[model samples]
Target: MAWNEPGNQGKDPWGNRGGKDQGPPDLDEVFRKFSSRFGGGGGNFNKMGVLLVLIGAIIVWGLSGLYKIEEAERGVVLRFGEFHEIVGPGLKWKPTFIDEVYPVNIQRVNRLNASGLMLTQDENVVTVQMEVQYRIEDPHKYLFRVTNPDQSLSEALDSALRYVIGHTTMDNILTVGRDKVRRDTWEELEGIIEPYDMGLRVVDVAFKEARPPEEVKPAFDDAIAAQEDEERFVQEATAYSRQVEPQARGRAERMLREANAYRERVVLEAEGEVARFTQLLPQYEAAPEVTRERLYLETMEQVFSNTSKVMVDNKDGGSMFYLPLDKIIQGGGSAPMVEQAPANRQTSTSSSGARTTSSDNSTGRSSVRQGRN
Candidate 1:
């Protein structure tokens, strides 16, 4: 009953004749059967499968080409390994394995430092440190214009620093000349980079430090201190001069004004004397004796105005008088009595009396003649 039995050998499980002699099913028949199950004929199945494969391939290639750029970045596109257009930040598409995109961050600032012991114009050695802040201005140039922009910038910084330091002095590099050194270095760097077009812009150049060699540091410090002292003294002297000069000028001006006033007063007084004498000349010439007597009295009045005086009237013709009034006043003693005159001459008194002066044993006599009315 089994199909593999000798009698059933000629027939297969599917009831086909000579089944043992038949190999596997025919390729054309298998294809026909598989296509019929999917409701497609043989040729249409092959074409549809090929179309689906092509579409999948195209989709994979397109997705592979899609890339993104950040807000701060720029894309440098290279088509077929050759330079192409630069693209801004956004979703970008390029042929897969054909065009390449290199994203560069243009907004970021980069820093480089250059330092070395350099020689100055005066042949002095100084260690100088400088820092350069820079940023990429052109991403294309930064990527292609120069093999390495950063390295180039660093070299330029070194060259600029050295050149500036070479032209400057050690004292300036270490002290007040720091700003000048930084500025000069910046200018020199810009000049050097300008011709290269490295697409790098220098933001700032900072002079970090400049110092003498360690072996001479102590001596330099002493020198710097001495320079500071000298400056301080000069400033103090300048301030003192500023303060004192004005006072001296004011005093000198005051003295000049006083001298001028004194001169004016003396000139005026002399002129007044001259004028008074000129006016009196005619009067004196008219009455010489009277004028002379009046002048003598006026002069005497002026002379005795400020002194302590004793007045004595010589009523008798002759008399001896003695007085120690100065000693009596100093010793707080009594005054001496007046002595009687001799009887030979008559005693006379005038409305205006004559004055006689006497000390302890000395006497001074003065005569006066009354003027006629």
Candidate 2:
């Protein structure tokens, strides 16, 4: 049967001993009873609750301010909307509502790329692509000094690149002068950023690509190919010259040395001849006739020593005798021995009708001697 039936009109499903309708128990009385059980008044309990709430809030605010910065990052702190100290990599804390922290990856390399069509110094148009690598050197300046450092850097890079490209030739942008263009752009970028103090350090600048526009690429390619061929030919010629020059120089040095040796030999021979003539002059002056005869005999003997034939004449009988000196020389005899003949035989040797006579023979024979040719 239902509890709110006619006989139990004031009674309900909840267990209440009275017939009057009742709501839930009062919260203030419930808290007051709980505090009485804890041996504290309601006012003291309220104060303790407030203290616990305050401590909990303080702990939460402190934990909320804690941050960890990685080894590659730096933290820039701002206090009351003003620049504060820069923090290195570590766990750090800041005031919750009064300070703000910005973590920047200072160690990480960041890259910005710029590419566009630019007019060159020679009034030619070309496409250039470049990349700038940089790092944050000072995080404080990076965060506060510029409104947008990355965008500023990109604009700076573009300006520098265009400036360099405008001052250079299209061929240089596209070919052998690429390194120069890259270096100039880098330097220009540094100069542009230095005055602003952007707190960015440019690690490197790479000129990634440069090319003529599509409408003129083929002609430019042909020109570049021709230039490459010319450079190759020049390098090959240089190498060949380097290789051959030493040999030519060596030949010239050898010829010079041989000429010097020949000159020295001729000079020494002339000096020797002069010395011999000087020694002979005194003897010739002491006894002119005897010396002249001796000299004549010596000269004749010297002349006949080179002949190949010998002729002997027997003066007593007017008979001529010929010795086959050429045959004798061919028979392995280089020299023939000449002796005084008998009294009846007179011997003479003539070299091409030249004669030398010897009269002091032991057998009273006159002898003329010659030599083989």
Highest TM-score, which number?
2
Q: Which 10-residue span in candidate 2 carries the lowest summed lDDT?
A: 350-359
CA-only RMSD, every prediction = 12.3, 9.0
The digit string of per-residue lDDT tens for model 1 on 98-200 reads 9999999999989999998999999999988999999888998999988988999999999999999999988888767889999999999999999889888
Instruction: State the lDDT at 290 in candidate 2.
Output: 91
lDDT for predicted candidate 1 compared with the true structure: 0.78
What stretches of model 1 exceed 4 Å from their correct place?
Answer: 1-50, 56-101, 264-373
- Backbone collisions counted per model: 0, 7
Backbone clashes counted, model 1: 0
- Candidate 2 structure quality by residue, lDDT tens digits, 146-199: 899999999999999999999999877777899999999999999999988989
| TM-score for each model | 0.59, 0.71
Q: What TM-score does candidate 1 reach? A: 0.59
